[model samples]
Target: MSQSSQFSLLSQRRFAPFFWTQFLGAFNDNLFKTALMVALTYDALSWTSLDPGLLNNLIPGLFILPYVVFSATAGQIADKVEKGRLARFVKLLEVAIMLVAGIGWMTHTLWLLIAAVVGMGVHSTLFGPVKYAYLPQHLKPEELVGGNGVVEMGTFVGILLGEVAGALLVSYRPVGIELVAGASLTMALIGLAASWRIPASPAPAPDLRINYNFVAESMRNLRFSAQNRTVFLSMLGNSWFWFYGALVLSQFPVYAKDYLHGDHSVFVLLLTVFSLGIGVGSLLCEKLSGRKVEIGLVPFGSIGLSLFGIDLYFASQAYTNTALVDAFALLATPGAARILVDLVLIGVFGGLFIVPLFALIQTRCDPQHVSRTIAGMNILNALFMVAAAGVAILLLGQGFSIPDMFLVTALLNAVVAVYIFSLVPEFLMRFLAWLLIHTIHRVATVDVERIPDAGPAVLVCNHVSYVDAIVIGAASPRPIRFVMDHRIFKMPLLGWIFRTAKAIPIAPAREDPFMMERAFIDIAQALHEGDLVCIFPEGKLTSTGDMNEFRGGIAKIVERSKVPVIPMALRGLWGSVFTRDPGNLFERSFSRGLRSKLALAVGMPVAPQEATPEYLYEQVRALRGEWK
Candidate 1:
């Protein structure tokens, strides 16, 4: 297995089925909901309640209620059952629910249709844990970012499609209600077919007994999540995102109609822009982070969310009556560019904010307990969404315009972000670490292309600085899972970044025999599964700024796995701030550069049969342009 093939999108079976399953599910969900909402909104006079606003508010509440009520139990069920089976069952439930929705549509029964919406919410709550937990199981740690990217993209695009389909189909009065009912049924059936194809994911804990006490079990799940401070904080940050998103998005219809003076089409246009922005941002995450779960992007996302959110308020203020405007008209309006920019940036930052957090939760949580932990997070997400509605209602009651609510939410986002980052400095800390390497240092490469473009390969690099892993990470086009010393894995801020990056922590036999063995086994499994496994062969940082004796660990790994070994060298980093060399505390001259030139050189791959420490050493030193 080569490094390139390890990270290739189409090569892995772990991802594709799950991707389509979730995508179709999301698409169907939005399609049904949007169609219902549009029907209710446009034909309010024909419905029982003349107040479209009240029905709108009530619908979201009804949908979210199930998440709050059932998520904890759903988590437990997912843990105890085979995830693939569970997913199929849930999709089947979706078909049944949509059928009920179709009946309601045909009969013009709003309440029955609303019940179906609630059912879909429950379906989503149950599927939520399975959706996230399944990823860590099948995906290599290195593929987490890209896999999540695709999932996120599919989800948003599905939402956009659903919204468009719902609005358009519900408005089409061909044969009164028959056409809408038929369209809904067809989409639901297609979604079920997609779900059926999800490959078998064996249950993680088949012997686990069911916990019927929802409150107590829910509390237990939350407490279990709290045990990992970073994971818990990530959940909180994630919840905050839902809170922010719900508040902003809930007002879109109003903003479009009241402020932009457009019809439902404008509402759809706004949603399409936002959803497309998220898809683009999500896909870009893998490229930007070098295919790692880079938490640094979280703060970057937060900053953009706040800045663009504030700017959106000003843009809205500049809008005059612009009703019935198509996408082009919206673009050409006086403040249109700013509004569009803000919406797109919000989506971009939202993607940045979300993808890493999901990866962090997946990688950091106990695998056995991950599904339940996600369930707890879903519960919080439900609460936040509910709270968003409550807040919006209160603001509207106080005579605030929808645009004003957007501004308030944007400002509040800044405050919440600052508070959360202050509490859990890992987000800010990773930002610092990411900044240090990318800005002050310009890493140059010689023979980087020597690293095999595909197949399983072991990277043996001479460790020099604390950030050796990050340097290698930045240089490689593909993601590499590092096998690091356990002690370094416990480093203050650096430890969190490494863990989130899914770097496997190892110890020498003398320190922790069991952990060491597990590390080696994991390495072998990763290789057999065709993943890039990188190790600092010197085992520890070079105290004298020179390569140390290469351990036989790399040799042993290759002997067992028969993977190629790519030797790498680092230079121009011996006296940097991260290095061991003593320097003036306040007047460090080495770290002060806009882009300091650094080098990462790669040597030709040594076959498993021919690899030797002495030969690889000479190759690395030669590539480094120096000898010691």
Candidate 2:
């Protein structure tokens, strides 16, 4: 299947049902929670003696508690059971929980509703691992970014829709009782219906014995995650995002009311802007990433989050009145442009930050324990969110304004980003790779459109310099998993980028037969699963400017996978700084803004049967065009 067609297939039974099922689940979660919040704020006198602020803080804490406590077990269950069946059952539980929420709403029983909220939290906790792990099983690796983008977009839009609905419906008083009961039940039914369409997802490790010791097992998962230093730190980076987000989101209600002097409608509008920003950013990830797990974007996201977050503080400083302002009024303020721009950038960078991390976790983690690792990440996310609330409470108690809190959070983000990237240099490495390819050279790619947009295909390119893969990556429209020399794969800084990109490292048959065989097997599997695989068939970087004889390895890959082979060529890189050209030791030759014009020319796909060293070489040579 072509990449576009494969993506379209996901909109069919195999994927769409699961997508909407998850969407509705997220939607209903926010719906009931928002309704409860409204009920507590406007009708708190009827529920309990607790202050709304305390309850607000307590509610988020209570909801996160299950993620911390139950994710370990949930991860186990997702691994042990069929995902489709588990999804349906979870939806059924949602129905029962929503019924409880209805009962609490009708009786105005805050305690009961809070319990139901906890129940929903537990449901989400269990669903977390399955929600992510399920994607690798159903979609092609090339589809990962697009699929994840859709999921993230759906989730945020669902939350926005749910909040809007909750605000409107909770105010509804049918026969003098809040109509939250009817709304919750109806949304639950819709979610259940969606779950019914989730196609079968057979368990990967169904016979694995259940581990009832949640603490020990959770710790084990965490330790396993830590074993892969890069993956582990990425998890931390992921968790920190939640912390950053929670702190920002927690202040919105207060910011709208106190700073902007807006009522409930303003609060909703602010959330809409934030959520819509996330949706836009998430959707853009697929495009920006070139359909790969582009970790380089993570640093970009962090930078924006911090910069915009600080700007937001200044934006809010311009506000002086307690009078209510609608969306238009808020936008009309002197500093509103900065605030709006910051919020939108924060969301955009957030999409860049998160999607790659999730993809990295999926692609890099052990297939057997991927779900468990995700669960462990979820636990950390829960902890970070809880801490965010606590930090916000502490800051507010210390007489810090919400805007000041945003500034503090923004500054802290820079510190955390520096620390995390320092520990796991892959983020920095990718940033370097991204920078080198994007800035150091102005690459013009031709015949890229000849590369199939979908299905399994082999890319044969001339290996010019050490950073050939990075350059190809930046030029190509789709992610291409490169087969690299084992030594280059182990380079100090470049190795991290290769590992994150899931580059297959190969040893020559004479050096390590086992490693060579494994590399071939990995390539075959990737192609079989419908991924774009690229190879430097010349085996090593060229000593001269001429392309070497293409090796039989390309033939071996195609013979096994029967995938189309697309020939590619890189020119004008021969005399570049990284190339083996003559240059003074301390002198930089191919610096950025030197007007160096790099070119990548691709050729039409050739049938596997017709693939040969000479034929492929000629195609690539032709694509390279006239070079100086």
Q: Tell me the tens digit of each residue's lDDT in model 1 across 1-628.
A: 5544323554455666677778878887787777776777767767676566556656776778788888899988988998888988888888888889888888889888889889989888889999999988888777888888878888999889988877777777766367667776787677677666677788888888888788888888899999988899899999998888878876776677668866667778888888998888888888667666788789988888888888898888887754567656776777777787789889999998898899888987888988899999998999888888888888888988887888898899999999988877657756765676678887676777666545689998888888888877767655578899899877887788777666899998899999989999999998987778899888788877888888778777877898889988888877677777666744545455567777888888888888877777777777777631
**Per-candidate clash tally:** 6, 2
Error of 1 at 584 (Å): 17
List ranges where model 1 is wrong by over 4 Å: 1-13, 174-177, 322-324, 440-569, 573-628
Cα deviation at 32, candidate 2, in Å, is: 1.2
> Which residue pairs come into collision in candidate 2?
2-454, 3-454
Off by over 4 Å in 2: 1-10, 172-177, 436-469, 473-568, 572-628
Q: What is the lDDT of residue 259 in candidate 2?
A: 77
Model 2: number of backbone collisions: 2
Write down the lDDT of every candidate, Cα atoms only: 0.80, 0.82
